[model samples]
Target chain A: MIWQLDIMFLVLVVISAIASVNVKDLLSSAILLGAYSFLMCLLWIEMGAVDVAFTEAAVGAGISTAFFIGFIFQTTRRTKD
Target chain B: MKERYPDVTIETVCRLLIPPIQLFGLYVIAHGHYSPGGGFQGGCILGASFIMMFIAYDIGEVKRRMREKLNTILCATGVLIYAGIGILCLVLGANYLDYGILHQILPAYPAKARALGTFGIEIGVGITVMSVMISIFLNIGTAGEHEGEPE
Candidate 1:
């Protein structure tokens, strides 16, 4: 595994994690979290855990993102705090 | 959400995309024993395809295709298949889920029987995961009042 790519994904993951929490719009937060999941998947692949990466891509990035969007539609899109 | 004007582009794109997504999901499940994917991941892919359909169309559309009762029944059936296989292995004079013993009934070698048994359980897991994902989305999206169209 290239250390550069690993570092890149690691930085991106941290940035997305913080951004998602700090975002005022819940929808944007959800999207950012999906991005975080994708980056984590990349890290997993780089570490040779291909099966975990596959699951992260499918459930973490794909299904959970859709679930979050669906949930956002049923509630307020903006955060109270 | 109120019914909005249907976007032809979105509908067309989703219709084209869903089939391939589902096919890939099945491929993942089928090749899971030798590959990086398995039942949970593949089933999530399959469920995500339907969720995409729900997004492009309406809840009524998905409901028409997969009724709540049918979905729930499918969820149970998957678990039943999983348990039945395990119990069958036990009744075959082996420990629970000991698939090597399956060779006695099937016309295959012990090792082949184990692979076949694992494949069967993967299928069961895939089925259960898919239905549960759909059920969760339906309940969350509609707030559990899925008897009729959202108003």
Candidate 2:
């Protein structure tokens, strides 16, 4: 239970985190950030932190994504970095 | 320009799903003692339902259901409920948040009173969390353009 799916989600977390920072589009970056949160939540669940996992899924995946998109509407989507 | 879909599919689906999601959120908050969920999780889910409403339709639709005034009151009320419980316990000759003193008023054992107290605080947490999330989303969504201007 500890090590079974940990490695997979760990890799995913790293990938998504990096991708979120590297992406040029702010919207895409925001979505990637959400994906990172989701993968981290999965890892938390894998480790039996179900409460934390639920929080991450709700706040990270649900609310933050909406905030990001809403911010995008208010601001610009293009990113120089 | 905001994108608007002509079809009613999203609207129909969201209408059907919103009630169930809210019910489940309440259940999570109430059933936290017996299950893995608690106040925070349930509040977030409840907040998400409103957000889902926003995504499915327009902001006006959600505003009609949950007004800005009610939202503001909820944020303050939730925290008040939490602190009020602590104060009540203090007045009851116990330390802050000590629910054992609640047994005097309730007809249950100390342990049961404590459990009931815990549940009360969880409800407070749920209300505050749900309102805060919604408030943050609304503020950031409008970028303060809607602030100080009650409509």
Candidate 3:
């Protein structure tokens, strides 16, 4: 059962990471990146490293995503592709 | 503050959600010892609460509510607290974080002293993480790009 959850979360992570890179709208991509980080946090929990999971959730999901969104606010929200 | 956007329902919902989210973040921080969550996770959640406000309201309101100078101070102070604890241990002629000395000073359970010491450092890390996260957001969100968009 735990392995199933891991697999499911892994799938979501892959999807979010790919979408974060591929999405045209900058805000959406940033949101997706946050999603990816959230999933990675869950993965860390599953791996039994609460400290690492906490750090990842804090830095990756909270800080990095906000930074990306701030870039969008200061610049264009659209992409060439 | 700028005019609240003409979405009464959204505003109402956000007003209700903010308190609960913030409270949950606090709970996560406090109950970190016997649980999977900790200062960093709780701090991230706390930062998210502000970010949500920023998105729901506006940047100007966020700036007013959480001034940049205060956040900078919090970030720096958090690190100082952590480093101070480590240095205190060093001064006491032990390793970087010999919590036993702390126990000796506190005049209580030694193991509890260790736990409390760790908790203090974790709190410091949390504060730094929270403020740094907000700083990164403010910096990135407000930066001006070069005038080279593909027009």
lDDT of each: 0.92, 0.87, 0.78
Residue-level lDDT of model 2, residues B1-151, one tens digit each, is 3556755998899999999999999999999998888999899999989888877886676777888889889989989999999999999999999999999998999999999999999999999988888878777776756534336
- Please identify which of the two predictions, 1 or 3, would achieve the higher lDDT against the true structure: 1
Q: What ranges in model 1 sit over 4 Å off?
A: A77-81, B148-151
Clashing pairs in 1: none
Model 3 residue runs over 4 Å out of place are A1-7, A45-63, A77-81, B1-6, B144-151
True contacts kept of each: 0.97, 0.83, 0.79
lDDT tens readout by residue for model 2, A9-66: 9988999999999998888999999999999889988999898888898888888888
Q: Which ranges of candidate 2 are over 4 A from the true structure?
A: A77-81, B1-6, B147-151
**What's the alpha carbon RMSD for model 2?**
2.5
Docking quality (DockQ) for each candidate: 0.90, 0.76, 0.53
Q: Whose lDDT is greatest here?
A: 1
Q: Who is ahead in DockQ, 1 or 3?
A: 1
Q: Given candidate 3, what's the lDDT at residue B34?
A: 76
Sorted on TM-score, best first, the list reads 1, 2, 3
